[model samples]
Target: MSTPAEFPVTWAPRRTRAVLLPVCALLVVMFAVIAVALPANWQFNDRVLMVLSGVLFAAAGLMLARPRISADAEGVTVVNFVRSRRLAWAEIVGVNFRQGDPWASLDLADGTSLAVVGIQSGVGKAQAIADARALRDLVHRHGH
Candidate 1:
């Protein structure tokens, strides 16, 4: 028979589009409108500035599509927007979720905490809290 600790555990926040691609698209549209609405006498530099601002918004939106946390027998992997870190269970000491924190994070044995962007407070308090507890449990059951 398989033991409880032997089972793999994967938990992530409930995905919401409240601030994802839809918002990104809206931001781009707004920028586009601004670009077109600018004075006809404006120099080429003004239009370039608007396009660059739109590009930044679109890039931010694309990054939001890739946050998650996954863990199994060996370790855990935290995939934030632009950075990803993989740590063995032995390297993690605990999980933390504090008020005002944007997301859940793991307390590493090395004294540094690794943020798990997959579970974010932006998703809502209840959901973020629940995921934090679940992640903490996984650490408790599997890690130190």
Candidate 2:
């Protein structure tokens, strides 16, 4: 007999720290340099604090650059930085891949377009195209 699976939905693959960490580091460094080079009295100024806070935020954002998807056996869950939404299989109207749009998109019955965020854009044009096609096929095969 086969064992039942554990989680119904899981986070899709994303770009690892090796890629995102450097970008974050660069920004942090730049901010730190500015913060340090400011007038001595400006260290306690609100503007300086604001800049430092922003730099800290950037680091946090970089550390959290993972794309996650969570759901039950019923549907898929997508949570990107700017948006968080869910789509049941029945709610998914269709899948489409085309030029200009980033990655694949799941067209919803309600008319909202949800971008698929798990794929890395830096993987090159060919990989992106293949990924888009693969996602489209998967959505078509299993999604409504």
Candidate 3:
């Protein structure tokens, strides 16, 4: 069996952040530059709106980068795009990351599953599989 990951471990989609953050920043800068370069006759509010739109886009990008999972001795904390949940080690039954799945997920004892978007196959398949295995090892060591 594989060794369990140490407590206080955290996993996130590095590629997603590396790619999305810079693109978002670039888009924001482009929007700001376009706003400033608008035709002289355009209303000032229009420029403000353009800049605000850019801010919104950046916010969305930030949200997309937010998914992460952190584990400690007591439990694991999962932070997805719009929600965060804490699950004790005992609460997790298993970790699943089948082919074609966007990300890994935790099957809980309560018959529910929680998506672990932090380990996304779309971002990096090999890394995601390794992460899922690490998580499975953790569950076997601590939860079972």
Candidate 4:
């Protein structure tokens, strides 16, 4: 059994953030250094382009850490790479994080399931399972 999570709690992929953010920072720095070290024949525009490319790469890396789940008294908000959805407690019917699954998912009242990427098993298995259980408890306590 998982311990109950407090209200207004937020869960994000800790390992993902820990790993990606630093790697992204390193890549960005490398890009900048490469831009500065480019041959003199390279135009200023070309160097700028390299720096811009690095920024874009960092942005993409940042997206990998974007998935998050925030729960409060009113409802739960799920944020994925490019989409964010808010669901009331009643809308969340169940939480599932079976073995081999990449992440947890929510069974919605609308007869559809929503992937909860914030609780990814591949990155941190134990934490993800605990979170899934906590979310299940929340659904049971608040979902009708």
Query: Best by lDDT, which number?
Result: 3
Q: 1-144 in candidate 1: lDDT tens per residue?
A: 112354465555546544577777887888888888899998778977897799797888878767888888788889888999898888889989999999888889999988898888887887778777877777776786
- Model 3's C-alpha root-mean-square deviation from the true structure amounts to 1.4
Which lDDT value does model 4 have at 25?
96
Pairs that clash in candidate 2:
none
- Tell me the tens digit of each residue's lDDT in model 4 across 10-46: 8889788999999889889999999999999999999
Error of model 4, residue 63, in angstroms: 0.1
User: What TM-score, over all chains together, does every model reach?
Assistant: 0.70, 0.62, 0.93, 0.93
User: Each candidate: how many clashes?
Assistant: 0, 0, 0, 0
Q: What are the lDDT figures for the candidates, one per model?
A: 0.79, 0.62, 0.92, 0.90
TM-score of decoy 1 = 0.70
Candidate 4 backbone clash number: 0
Clashing residue pairs found in predicted model 1: none
Better of 1 and 3 by TM-score: 3
Residue 113 in model 3: shift from native, Å? 0.6
List candidate 2 segments past 4 Å from native: 1-17, 41-43, 46-72, 120-122
- For model 3, residues 1-144, the per-residue Cα lDDT tens digits are 444535689999988889889989988999999999999998999999999999899989999999999999998999999999999999999999999999999999999999999989987788889889998899888997
Error of 1 at 93 (Å): 1.6
Scored by lDDT, model 3 comes in at 0.92
